[model samples]
Target: MRSATSKARFPILLLTLLVSISAAAGEKLTALQLFQAKRYAEAQIAYEQLAAADPGNAETHFHLGLLALRRNATDTAIAELERAVALDGKNSDYFAQLGSAYGAAAQAAGLFSKAGLARKCRVALEKAVELDPDNLDAREGLVAFYRQAPAFVGGGIEKAYAEAEEIKNRDVLAGSLLLAQLATGEKKYDAAFATLDRVLADHPDAYLALYAYGRIAAESGLRLDVGERHLRRCLELPPPARAPAHAAVQWRLGLIAEKRPDLPAARAAYAAALELDPAFSPARDALARLPKP
Candidate 1:
């Protein structure tokens, strides 16, 4: 019943729609690529555009929230992360990131609001862990919360230790590092060092264990020479996904150098840290505070 002109018009409209869909997909891919490359500024703009075009796209909102967090935009990150969680409640990562955003907001909040924000963070992180027990990042956040929050807020040192044990049961390397961290926080430096030493003995090539040895020394101001040696060894190994970035190892080296009163070494180490990650604010701050030669 359709006229030839009408049929031709239908084909043209279909082709246009197909092309538009393809363009949208391509844009999303490019945005993701930028994000993976750590080009946060560009990724943020791209994600903003995508979110505007597809308001229901949870992934875009999630990445946008992460970008906001990188820039210390806590309120914006919370909003975007909340939107992502609302859109997809089943995503463990969304909950984990939302919990972190809440924790950041708590830090900046007045005393009266701090308890409430902290509670929100705990609840969100707990939910994330419940959703995905294997999510070590979520567990680590919960462990941190347990370590820092008062008993009145459902947190305690015992709880933190228990959570670390759970993490250790899953991934021995991550768990050992975490346990060492907790022990160090409690001023149990000997225990921390022993734990790391055992891991290194079992897996000599474990760069994370090496980094932890350096971190403990940096924090306790003990064994600076040994720590420097271990840290340098870390640099010789290829980093794993879960290990601290090279910048962090470099920062620790800077800390050791400072403790040694070797200003030049400290400056050079901090500079190297910044070279690895220009956005590493701690290195930048350390550099700024260093006395001018």
Candidate 2:
């Protein structure tokens, strides 16, 4: 277990202070500006003040819940989100976040306790989808539930596949990658690749699809050559088409090279990742772990 002082802190959420917030009717924008500036500690304090001032504001609690989740304070996240849902019972997004918190907490729980948390996750996610049929994240959370939990508790690839079909009908690009990811989770590599093939065929320049393709290939140790190719292409894309987190693609490339036992390639990729964003700890750690030559 980590030390108590650090358990609820994330430096990534505390990085920049460039953008300023214009004075607005609501202080929520102020908190948002702080969050965007990566001043997470200040943002949390601001959010706490907002929540205290407006005890009935559901959105305040929701934002606090998000901040807590980013800090890995899942228990706090669940509490804040519960308040959000209690105040605004109609919000699908609130319930979805609560479910995500439950899921995160369940990862470290004992077997019996894990089951209970999983049940909470399942219930909240289902409620979110019921409240909003078009809630994509809620639907994906439910799919994750079916993929990971036991049959008695709600896990089933069959359920995930059914949800995948619904997603497919909604957004072809995202849906295809999501379906492929689900297939990957099921250990159906061939099927997953075939689905990805369709994604590439239809939208050859898609940012999400390329990242998904690279991630699956690297993580699964399948089609390494193809994975490396697409991952490199993903890294080369301009900001508009690049992944929101630019260093992520470089890390994926590093992962591919490392898994292939290509030490020099892995080191280069990791170095490139750190060059893009020195705060990217995964790349930094990977680079540090390489044997001194």
**Judged by TM-score, which candidate is best?**
1
Off by over 4 Å in 1: 218-232, 235-293
Q: Each model's TM-score?
A: 0.80, 0.74
Among these predictions, the greatest lDDT belongs to 1
Q: Show the lowest summed lDDT stretch of 10 residues, model 1.
A: 235-244
lDDT of 1: 0.93
lDDT of 1 by residue, 1-293 (tens): 99999999998999999999999999999999999999888998899999999999999999999998999999999999999999999999999999999999998999998998899999999999999999999999999999999887778999999999999999999899889999999999999999998888889878988998998998899989988999999988888886788899999999999998898999999999999999999999999999998
Q: Please list all clashing residue pairs in model 2, or write none if there are none.
A: 14-38, 146-156
Misplaced by over 4 Å in model 2 are 1-24, 36-38, 219-225, 239-293
Each prediction's whole-model lDDT (CA): 0.93, 0.85
Q: Which pairs in model 1 have colliding backbones?
A: none
Q: Kindly provide the TM-score of model 1 when superposed on the true structure, using C-alpha atoms.
A: 0.80
